[model samples]
Target: MRNNVQPSNLSPDPRADLMVALSTDQREHWQHAYGAHPHMYGDQPSAPALHAVEVFRAAGARDVLELGAGQGRDSLYFAQRGFTVQATDFSDVGLEQLRDRAAAEGLNTLRTMVVDVRDPLPQADASVDAVFAHMLLCMALSTNEIHALVSEIRRVLRPGGTFIYTVRHTGDPHYGVGIAHRDDIFEHDGFAAHFFYRYLVVELAEGWHLRDIRAFEEGELPRRLWRVTQSLTG
Candidate 1:
């Protein structure tokens, strides 16, 4: 973790009052959760991250950018595999823990950044070789926000850059059970998730070469997800 990383604040959005409110609450919830339960997700990388290592390596990727890197488990794993990783999340508490672990492990290839995916990415255009986001696209983001975020991902990735991300899909058990927000968003136990339908995935991959969309499950809730892989033309 680098010392110069600055935290980003969620700016109010006049267009979507509900989105801004939910995002703010979600950020605070994640911070408090990480503060109360350090290493909550444990040190092991998620199955998607494990799979991403092979995908990234086969694509000859070196530099990686990770979004929603809670506590950096996957970020650290990527670094361990010799990929230089920039791990980012909205929660500073989670990122601080990530930085401490990276420093303790002496992993110079890994760094942390505080970023809210709703905003334009801080990276320059075509700056990274690969991008990974494990269950990030499903967060409380609205449909338009998700599209905008994918646009930013495309902007930051180089030609031929592999982009892999996982999202809890509409098949999830908790999908419609929680407090409902617009655009398929639902809040359960303080975490808001915008469950994706297959059509949304296809729409997001319109111009890119969509390699795969594999259905999988995670957690005790068995959160149903689709791990999507796509790439740009070299």
Candidate 2:
């Protein structure tokens, strides 16, 4: 993370806001965006992804695992804050850019790897202090995949480590992103995308207790996005 990247109280984007609040058309846009630029989406940190750092920080997390850490935004932010951050993402191209960006910003605390979140993490069991994913899971797999991934999360976390996340909401239509319905399905960049405003309460399965949950919807153009967030703690 760059030493100068502070948590700014910067204003939000209206387009992003609309998508979050009423994003039935998001899948199409994202697929298009990814097709156009496979290395990144929107060239910035995701709205909920940014907030996860604060969630951990406020919860007093020291070491963190950022799963599906595409651009290294959350990972770098945590690293810059003195947290030992292990950032993981599956895209080789995305990870390359992340490494390049990290190098340019001199963020070494962020140790990164290219791995599928559906598989076991390259970590010792019960070793992490906290785990976080921002809008990463639902975009990657089906509800069945979510359960398996959640199982993996359970295996890596300490008996009482925290898991924090934000995911797409099902049936939100105002955002103009995709087909709004239960599965949070959408069409994007020529590929089919499916996701939803979803939640899973797995304790023993995830190796933690559900601590808190919050949801955010795109309020306006400058602040568009729906964020379903939570803290899982020991």
Candidate 3:
């Protein structure tokens, strides 16, 4: 767990505004979610993602890329495991806290950088031995944009390089919960927020073949999460 992590005055919630919640109209939901519960996001990498990382490591992946590594939980874990990892995200605050946690844990080998996956990836083609998108590609993107991201991963990875990631399901109401009329803004707990999500069609993408697809609809009816895996087929 990340000790001394700063907490924010936000609430954990699932607003009733469905359309806006999943769209960019309410994307900052994550910021607030992490702000309200830094430890939850900082220490607790998703269960499916964690399991996937273990499996990848067992399969001989060493160098790793974490696209949306919040608070460096996964990054530090990989570094401690002796795998070289470069984790990137657009949130400086999140990365700073991640660094603080790493410093506290004495895992100085972990590398954290500020990179936005929406732009061109910062590494050279075939540079990384393996890539971990985690929960990155699913955020605030159109279907085509998400496909482009997958394609970009393929382009960057060397032959036989692996790209691991997870996509939220289409039925997740929390994904696009509340949005303003313009569809780019949302209001929650008396605060207005901005957000987007367009990754409901990962099963239809070209190139990569599905390795493991887990359906997580066992919770409160309609379920809220899905786990999908892909292997780069060049």
Best by lDDT: 1
lDDT of 2 by residue, 1-234 (tens): 212223222243334434343332443444345446755544455566567667667767778988877666667667777888888876555666677877888887778887765456778888887788876665635445566677777778775566776654444443336443323446443333344432333322243455555656543332222343333455
Measured against the true structure, the TM-scores of the candidates, in listed sequence, are 0.93, 0.68, 0.71
For model 1, how does the per-residue alpha-carbon lDDT over 1-234 read when each residue is reduced to its tens digit?
Answer: 212133222254455987888899999999999999997999888999999999999999999999999999999999999999999999999999999999999999998999999999999999999999998999999878888899999999999999999999878999888799877789998889988878788888979999999999999988999999999999
Off by over 4 Å in 1: 1-15
lDDT of model 1, residue 5: 30
Give the range of the ten consecutive residues with the poorest summed lDDT in model 1: 1-10
How much RMSD separates candidate 3 from the native structure?
10.7
- When sorted by lDDT, best at the front, the candidate numbers are 1, 3, 2
For TM-score, candidate 2 versus 3, the one ahead is: 3
For all candidates in order, the CA lDDT equals: 0.91, 0.59, 0.61
Off by over 4 Å in 3: 1-37, 40-42, 180-205, 217-223
- Per-residue lDDT value at 56 in model 1: 96
